[model samples]
Target: MSTLVSKVLVGSAMAVVSLFASIDINNASADELMTLNGIGKGKAEAIVAYRKNHCFKNANDLSSVKGIGSKIVEKNRKEITVGECKK
Candidate 1:
């Protein structure tokens, strides 16, 4: 039973790590965006919307969103990628 529990825990952690490994804001879908901490469906949609309307110059551009402050950006920076598209 303990081994089963440990395996489950490790599997869950690995899944989360893999999820994070593939989260690139430049290309993430709404579902993927929602997986990020502090980002709900609305914010995820907003991010997609923002990406459509304007280019993300860098991680800093996330701050332009009404609710995405620097702290949030800082926390999720590793999960995001601005790509070569920038100001």
Candidate 2:
């Protein structure tokens, strides 16, 4: 039972690591963007549009948009990426 619990904990940690590592906004679709916390369809559209118009150089650029705030950024930080360089 102890071994099983250890395995479960390790697996959970790996899953979380992968989630943070794979948040490539360049390839994310509208539906995927919406999955981020505090993101709705409109905010998702703004994200995509911003990427198209100016190209994202870093995650901090997201805060420049009209509706995004620090709270939203913190909430969605794990599910978003910028400067992907291949949109």
Clash counts for all predictions: 0, 0
**Candidate 1, residue 52: CA error in Å?**
1.4
lDDT of each: 0.80, 0.74
Q: Predicted candidate 2: what Cα RMSD to the true structure?
A: 4.2
Per-residue lDDT of candidate 1, residues 1-87 (tens digit): 699999999999998787767466766789888877798988989988888777777888887877889988888888877665432
Q: Which stretches in model 2 have alpha-carbon errors above 4 Å?
A: 1-21
Q: Candidates' TM-scores?
A: 0.71, 0.64
Residue 53 of model 2 has an lDDT of 65
- Mind giving the per-residue lDDT tens digits that candidate 2 earns over 1-87? 699999999999998875565455666777777777787999888877877766656666677777988788787776677745664
